[model samples]
Target: MLIQTLAAAATTAAPQNKFGFVEALQAGGFIAYATVSILGIMSFGSFYILFTKFFEQQKIMRQGRDVGTSFWKAPSLRDGANKMDKNSAWRQLVDDGLAAEDQHGKMTDSMEAHDWLHGSLARSEASINARLAGGLPFLATVGATSPFIGLFGTVVGIYRALIAIGLAGSASIDKVAGPVGEALIMTALGLLVAVPAVLAYNWLQARNKRIAENLNGFSTDILANINSKGAVRPAAIAPAKSAAPAAAAPIKK
Candidate 1:
């Protein structure tokens, strides 16, 4: 009798892992499966963009230090440009500025050299910004749409639960729990996917904005230097002297 009681107690105490993700998938039909698959794809894409853009931004930041030290200190604009990393945005801007100086007459001889160089640098900065902004749209899309996708799954799950209650002819715990749990899981999954994507998108965009500001400031400095010393022969600039002659008093008498 004691052995029987212990056996019964052990059986009752055994934990039941109920209708989890796999079970939901099994019972959720094609719509549920498709929704999950789409969310999975979106998650993968968001993470990929986040990581790639992160590394890319870090590279640009490191290049910023290089530009401040090596590029600015070089003797000539062309030499400064050459000192930069070959494929970096800073190098590209410098090359564009030099090219503008070289090709000043090709567009129209009437345009001032300052304006031509400014326009070229502007264009280069815009190109770099556009490149940095790539993949951001995908992250935005995922963040915006993932919740709706999850809601769709939840609605479907609830609908299935209602059908299940109808078939069982009772709204008991067993009848209500499975479908409700599945629906809640869908909602949770959707939020899980969306929150990170939104956070990552915002973070990346903020970083991009900072980088763009730096680029614009750098362009402005380059333009100022060009105006002051001329892009080609920066070393030849000389300070202007006052027109007044020194110690000219009585010699004329």
Candidate 2:
């Protein structure tokens, strides 16, 4: 009899929703939907920048690796330029250097020629680095502002909750549940948007730094090659396997 009475009372109590995301938004009206839409756009933009920049960075780095293998193997600057993709950043640098070389002949002294070539390559490298850095500011802005945007929603939700209390003349669960849930959801969504943007910004910036360093190194090599009239190239280290085979062959013979 006691168990039956408790079960009947449980069923008699108000039936609450199992999920409230939709309900909470509806309760908050236009403000809730607007906030969500803004966050959605920011999330989408952040991902787009991250992916586009990553692929671009990867392409430049891949080209840099190819330079180590094939670029130096060419006998002359004009020959090396032919071996690279015409559209590539490396190709642009070589072309600029060659152009500067041609024009530098009009200069009276060897120092003037060297300065002209160095400045041309430096300018080309700087332009490439600047291009790579283009979308990073968007990621930074999203990371910094998204949390505040979310806080605005939280503040609005809290205000709504207060209004609900005043209207009902009581702090009832039914009266304030929607607004409180909205507040929590806004906070969580803000964090979700912010963390990824911050991470991507830092990660991509680090990679850009690495790429810049490699570009600088390559620029130095190119400058040396230009000044030396293709006489100077970075010495290639023999692979350990090739050295071991040579050592063994000598002993066997």
Candidate 3:
């Protein structure tokens, strides 16, 4: 009788939890599904940005090597600019400097031409930096907000659990475990999503800073060259007015 009673008690004991993520999702309802979907999107977007930006930065860094060798070896500013990859940041800055030198004389009330050229280079550098920083804000948003979204789902799960308990009139392990597991899963998923986003944001930000620093240094070199060699005349300068032919003087001969 003792052995039989023990066997019956063991059989009645709660079965091992075969329940898992899918079951939790099924029990969590629409709110849980939505939360997971949003987190999934955030994760995908952050990873995509991280990878694309990494490749872009790597390309720029490699271009830096080319700039060091080929650009300086060229005979003139135009030649140096041509030696750089056409789409490179260094080439862009050089082009802007050349344009600024050409256009400075045309702007009424402009500062000294040197100052104008420097300002144009500065603006070009800023534009490149801004382009490099694109998509970073979205990573930051995901890092900052994903946890809250998860917490919101957790709250909903707990509320549902309470309702289930109330309806069943008993807080048995089976009734309580599924909802609690769902809530915990939501929290864990949130942390998982947020951690990568935050890491990627920081890593990408650091890389951007390095790129920006490189751009600033390159711009400075271009400005120095412009200052030393006098601005390269653009193809479009108007012919200098020839001094009216010395007023064909009376034939004093």
Q: Write the per-residue lDDT of candidate 3 for residues 1-253, one digit (tens) a residue.
A: 9999999999889586545899989988888899999999999998999999899989988997777667766767788787778898878998999898889868889478778888999999999989999999999999999999999989988998899899999998788788888999989889999999999999989988988888887787777777778343322232355776666668865
> Which residue pairs does candidate 1 place in steric collision?
none
- Candidate 2 TM-score, true structure as reference: 0.85
Q: Which has the higher TM-score value, candidate number 2 or candidate number 3?
A: 2
Candidate 2 to native Cα RMSD, angstroms: 6.6
Go through the candidates in order and give the clash count of each.
0, 0, 0
Score each candidate by Cα lDDT: 0.86, 0.88, 0.85
TM-scores of the candidates are: 0.84, 0.85, 0.82
Cα lDDT tens digits for candidate 1, 61-161: 99987776677667888887877778898888878877877798587548888888899999999999999999999999999999999999999889988
Which model is ahead, 1 or 2, in terms of lDDT?
Answer: 2
lDDT of 1 at 247: 70
lDDT of 2 at 140: 96
Query: What stretches of model 2 exceed 4 Å from their correct place?
Result: 1-19, 107-111, 237-253
